[model samples]
Structure formats: structure tokens, C-alpha cells
Target: MNTKTLVSICSPVYNGEDHIEDCIKGVLTQTYENFEYIIVDNASTDNTPSIIEKYRKKDSRIRVYRNEKTVCMDDNFNICAGYCSDNSKWIKYALADDYLFPDCVEKMVKVGEMDEQIGIVSAYRIAGRYVTSMGLPIEQNVFNGAEILKQQILLKLHVADGSPNTVMYKKSVFFEFNGFNSKYNQSDVELVFKLLDKYKFGFVHYVLTKSGRDKKGGFYYLVKHGFHILEYLDFGYKNLSNYKSISFDKDEMDYLKMYYARAIVSFLITKCAYFEWEDIKRMLGNIPEDIKKEVKKTFVRDFPKHIIKYFVSLLRRIKSYLRDKKRFEQFT
Candidate 1:
């Protein structure tokens, strides 16, 4: 095993006592041995730090750092990556709640080493019970960045857009984009799109990681409160316009514009109660002016029909409850 390439494996954690050990063990057990495991504790008020220290004393490769105070997830992630050794050529993120298979690093590095132009390497991941990061051709090992971006925008491919657990990035390219943006909740997805705009994309057709779906995580909170729709709209509107390489014809762009507008209006009509008025306004404010106007117009036109449908559905639910009650009464 000639470990020529040094990978900086990073994990940023806060109050992750429940699963941090599993994450640490997964990294320590990697089949590929030449790597530095960097763990940055975000001032966790739990057993997380002690658990990390326990491992740190056992393995010389494990380096631990702690923030004086907790910071935003994206900011902490950036800080973790910043601690990578200068000699490292690649950066791999094993999130605190997620774990990778034994051969995960070996397979990903193999693809990455195949070409210097390949800046991002992705593979299938078991998210809960199902495998994801699909839609790449089985026979193809690499793709042009612009073409991959086009496929992602058109909803034809999903290999390039996944959580940190599913991908490995070139250390230089990761820093070139200045790491994840702190403002957006889906900064990992945003970074992938940005990377694909410049460098080549590589794929490994095997499931190499398992992503834990923590219901208490920020992503789950947003989706549970129906705020993910707005965040996604903001992410798409901001990044999709910057890629001049991914050209969309007039009709396609028009369809996508209306598609976004309708999505917003639908969310407003159905899930408005989940959000505060001020929050709704703030989220909508980030959207482009033209799309905001289209959302308003779509809301005005569709509000009545959606209300009618909602009342009808509510009435049906009431009727079903009444029927069940009547049956119980007869049995009594």
C-alpha cells in the first residue's frame, strides 16, 4: 500500500454523543490508511469531546480541535476544512451522524486519481434504507462538468448533488470556492453545483456510505416546517443564473420559471400556517423580482380553487369520522 495521496477527513460536530463514536470508528477503520482524521468540536456540552479524546489518545492520526463557542453549521464546517494539513491532496467529509464503508476512501480515491481534472468524486450512498446519488450511466466513469450541471438543472441526473457523506473533493478546488456559503442551509448542494461549473465530475457505481436521517437536524426541521421549499427556490434562483455554460432555450426557461412560481404559490396556499408572516416575506424577498411577481399573480389566480379543494377535503374527513361514530353507536 503506497499511500502517496494524503486525504484530510473532516468531521464537525455539536452534541453528537449518540453517534460520533460510530462516525469516528468508520473513519479509523478505512481500508485506505494514509489520511489525517480532523475532528472539530463545536463546543458540545455532551460526552462528544471525551469520546473524541478517547480515540485521539489511541490514534496518532486523529487531531482534535474545539471552538470556544458554537457557530453556525456552515461556518464550523469551513473552520474544520481550514484545519486540513497543507500536504493533503484531497478532502473527505464524514459528517458526525454519518458513516462510510471500509472501502469508501479507496474507491473514491481511485476515481479521483484517474484524472487531475476530476475535482469532485461521488458515489451511491445508502440514505436510510434506499440507495441514492443515482442517474449516472453505469459504464461511464467521468463526465464534463458543464454537461453534469445541465443534467442536474434539467432534473436528469442527481449524482453531482448530494450530502457531504457521498462525495470527495480536491483540496485545491474546495478552497478555490472558499468552502461552503454560510448563508444558505443547503450550502453543500450549492457548492456541488458551483464545482461542477468548472471541473470534471467522477462517479463510482457502488454504495460506499450510509447517511443518517436525523429528524432533529436542521434539514429535517426545515422540511418539517415546510420551509425547505422556499430555501430550495432561493438556492436555485441564485446559482442557476450564474452558469452561462448551461444554456437553456426560451421555452425551457419559461417553463422552469412558471414551475417555480407555481411551487411557491402552492406552498403558500397549503402550508402558510407553518411559517410566520415575517419569515415568509423574508424568504420571498430573496427570490428574484420577476419570479416574486409571478408568485403573487399565481397566488391570486389559484387561491380560490385551492381553498375550495381544501374545504372539500376537510368536509370529507368529517363525514368519514361521523360515519365511523355512527357505526360504533349501533354496535353499542
Candidate 2:
């Protein structure tokens, strides 16, 4: 391997004892060997630190750093990304719970090398199967940045398809936006919107990663750092007028508002189901009354959809539980 273009692979960990080793191995075993692996531990109390040390001793290319105290997830992510070497031109951010295919870097870099204007290269990711296949076939590998942003704003792009785990970006582009913004729970989506405001994004029609939703730090983490519906609505509201390259007409803007309102109500119902009233109320504080009214209205209209999805999710969980119980029985 020529390994001419140096890529920086960054992963941030906190109490990820179970998944950190496999995550490290996924990076170390990459077929493209010219990359530096940077791992940041956010003062984890678990065995994560030792697991990282064990790998650090074996791989000279691996560099490990520790934060004195735990920081926000976005801050930890920025710290990991900042450790890239001066010579490194590209960065691949791998989440601690995710696994990367061996050819991920090779494939992404190849597409990135096709054009200097290409700021990000993304590949398909598997959660259950091509999760981003939004009932439409993709016909092109390269898309105009403004167009993609427009699709995203219009709710045509699947959010999972735009996750950082399946994407790689140029080092310059990451810094140009000052790394990820911590305000939005969907920080990755905000970054995508900002990047697409100026640069082109390419796609590789291959599944190069598997997304893991386990080990999400449980309930307290959800209350502290989880995605809130209002945050997303606020993001959509705040950024609607900020795009320089793409402009939405009046009708389009109205449609987007309705779209966001529907999403807000769906999430509100979900939060009400799981969280206490006080937590949900605190998250919704300072949000305008008009928005709340719209959410209430949409909740009434969309209540059945929410009920259907809840039942579907419950049934899936039951099936998974039974399957696990059967496997345990067999093993015993």
C-alpha cells in the first residue's frame, strides 16, 4: 500500500468497556494502513482505560489521550479530532460502539481523491439493512452540496445516512466550521448542513459500517445528553434562514414548518411515554407557545401513528427477548 494520503481515525470513549476493544481492533485492522488512530477517554471509571492501554502497547500508530474530567460528547469528539497530525488531510470519526469494515478508509479516500471540492464522502451503513433506502433508488455517486442540504431540510434524506460513523471528511473542512456544535443533540446533522452550505459531498454505494445502538449509557445519560424534540425543532427553526447557497420559497418554508411540527409532536409523545412530566416540561421550557400549540394539534392528528409505532417497537422487543431466552436455554 502506498499509504500516501494520511488519514486520521478518531474515536471517543466513556465507560465503553465492552465495545472499546472491538472498536479499536476495527481501526487497527483496516486494510489501509497509513492512518493514525487517536482514542480519547473521558475519564472513564471502567476497564476502558486498560483496554486502550493494551492496544496502545501493541500498535505504534495508536495514540491515546485522557480528559481530566468528563466533558460534553461533542467536546470529547472535537478533542479526538484535534489530535490529527499536521500531515493528515482526511479524518474518519468512528463512534466507540460502531464497527468499521476493513476497506472503509480505502473506499472513502478513493472517492475523496476524485475531486478537491469534495468535502465529505459517505458510505451506506447497515443497522437492519440499507436503512437509508428511503423508498427511492439512488442514481448518482456525486451530488451537489446545496441540493443535498435542500433534500435534508425538506425531510427527504434519512438522518441515519448522514451519521458521522459512515462518513469521512477533509481535515480543513472540519476545522472551517470549528468542529461539531454541542448545542444541537443532532450535532452531526447540523454539521452536515453547514458543510453542505459550501462544499460537495460524495457517496459510495457500499455498506462500510455497522451501527450499534447498545451501550448508550442508559437512562441518566438519556436525560442528560439525549436528543430532545425541541432541540431539533429549534435547530430547524434557527437554520432555515441561514443558508447562503440554497433558498426556499414561501410554500416550501411553510411545508418545512409543518414537517418539523409533525416530527416534534411524534417525539413529544415518545418522551411523555418514557420520561417524567417534569423532565419533559423542562426540555420544553422557553419554547414558544405557537410551537406548542402546533405540537398539540399535530399530536391529536398523528396519535394513531405514534400508537402504531409504539406497538411495533414493543413487539420487536418481545421477539428479541424471546429469541435471547431461547439461545440461553440452548447454551445451558
Candidate 3:
């Protein structure tokens, strides 16, 4: 009798013909073989569907599903997850653009089985050339989810939450939390934060997955709209009450105030074109009124100093440009 834990691996793809084969091969070649590979194509108009079908024929473990209509990415993710076998103990998301190391599932499952309280398991991931999610201690493999969540909020740790591709979720815990929130673009981050608030976190200190770091992907979208920092701040603020042991020292509070102030100013200066007023208002809505007022006050008090610095930098750039133009004219 094969007694190993059954795992369900899912890949949600849309126009992913470029990397779907690699993603599939990563799963098919997993060192741990007792698992199902689910591929949900989000109505891809390209060769993605055919590529998936090619693999499904070769491997009976591969299951393919197609959406009649292309759904939002978050919705598609939830739809993909919904197809997991009820008998499976864990759900591992292998993003269409990202592939796993051969031992990825084996390693993540080993850590997860170490503790029943561990609701999420994460490992280091290669983001481009650098290994990321590195704040955890070298020897420690498990953590109190609340403490990890607190540290993550305070910017002290980043081991527990990251791209779905880098982590595995307890099947029960995932459904208990109702999966991803379709309303937020950063729903994966949001869901991980929510999970860490009430459950233990497990970490495998190995680089198990490679992130594609697509410049046109979700992270870039968040950064382009200036929603990345604000969304994180909003998550931190909303979860503060849940971390009863967490307390901010005066310095930390001051730093956060300045950080919030700078984010607001930076968004206005650089990201205004990509954001609507309503979108900005909604992002800021989750943050507390007191913190909002404090940051506004901080921004007001520091406005003149900021203006002076901006003018000085602007003047220097203007001088450099004129000097360069003069040098070119003389050469001509």
C-alpha cells in the first residue's frame, strides 16, 4: 500500500504558451510522485491549450480544465484550486510562468508534515538571479504564525508570505479562509497574511522555485499604480488588532508615520497617471483615521523641506542639461 500523503498541484494559466511546458515538466518530474497535476487554462487564445493537451495525453496524472470565458486572474486561481481532489492534503500552486525544482513538493511537504498547526509552508525562491524570502533564522524551521505576521508587518521578516508559487497551503486551512479575495489585486499576499494571523508557519530554508519576474505581471501592475506600499500598509493596519502581543515603540511609530507620508507624496508625484481618485481613496480607506491624520500632519510639517530639496535637485538637473547642450553645440 502506498501510504505517502496525496498532494494536489495546480497551475492556472492564461496565454502561457511561453512557459507552460516548463511548468508541466517541473511537476511531472517531481521527486515525490504521489500527486495530481491540475492545469486550468483560462481560455487561452494561443497554443497553451494544445501544449497542455499534449502533456495530458502523455501523463494520466495530468488533468486539464478549460474556462468557457477568461476570468479575472484571481477568479481563475480560485477556480483552479476548486478542482483539487478532496482526498488531497495540500494544495501547491505552480504558477504558469514559474517552475519548481524537482524536489520542491517533497521538501515543502516534509516541512508541513512536521506540525499539524502549520497552515502554510514556504521556501526560498529564486527571483531572477537573487534568492528571496530570506529573513528567517538559519536553524529555525517553524514559527508562531502570529509572531511571523507581526514581524512581517513591522518589516522584520519575509519568510512566511510570498508568491503562491513559493508556498504550499493546508487544504483545510485554505478552504477555511475561503481562498483568495477577488477584490484585491494582491490577494495572495492578503490571504497569506490572514492565514498567518491564526496558524503556525513552516519554512524550508532552500530555494525550491524560480520566479519569472515578468515585468508586465501583477507585481509591476501594483507598482505602476502605486498600490504596492499602500496595500501592504492597509494589510498591516487591518491586522493590528489581531496581534495582541504586538506593540509599536515610539521610534517605530515615528518611522511608520514618515514612511506613510513619503508614500503618499511619492504616489502623487510619480504614480498619479495610473491611479484614479476613487482607487486611491479605497486603498487608503482601510488605514486608520488617526494614522492617516498623523501622516498628513507629518507631510504638512515637512512640506517646505521637501520643496527645497526638490528645487535643488531640479536646478542641478537643469544646469547639467544646459552644460551638455553647450558642449554639443560647441562640438557641432
What alpha-carbon RMSD in Å does predicted model 3 have with respect to the real structure? 3.7
Candidate 3, residues 1-332, lDDT tens digits: the string is 66999999999999999999999999999999899989999999999999999999999999999999999999988898899998999999999999899999999999999999999999999987888999888898988888887778777777756699999999999999899998777888889888987889999999999997778888888886667776777667545665554667878767666666676755554333444776566545655666678757766776777668777888999999999999999999
Output the better candidate (1/3) by TM-score: 1
Considering lDDT, where higher is better, how would the candidates rank from best to worst? 1, 3, 2
Which candidate number has the best lDDT? 1
Clash count in backbone of candidate 1: 0
**Per-residue accuracy of model 1 over 141-160 as CA lDDT, tens digit each:** 88898999877766567786
Off by over 4 Å in 1: 224-227, 238-241, 273-276, 300-332
Q: Write the per-residue lDDT of candidate 2 for residues 268-330, one digit (tens) a residue.
A: 677777866665676567455656676678879899989899989999999999999999999
Q: Distance (Å) between predicted and true CA of 212, model 1?
A: 2.1
Is candidate 2 or 3 superior in lDDT? 3
Q: What's the lDDT of the predicted structure labeled candidate 3?
A: 0.84
User: What is the TM-score of each predicted model, taking all chains together?
Assistant: 0.87, 0.82, 0.85
Q: Cα deviation of 316 in candidate 2 (Å)?
A: 14
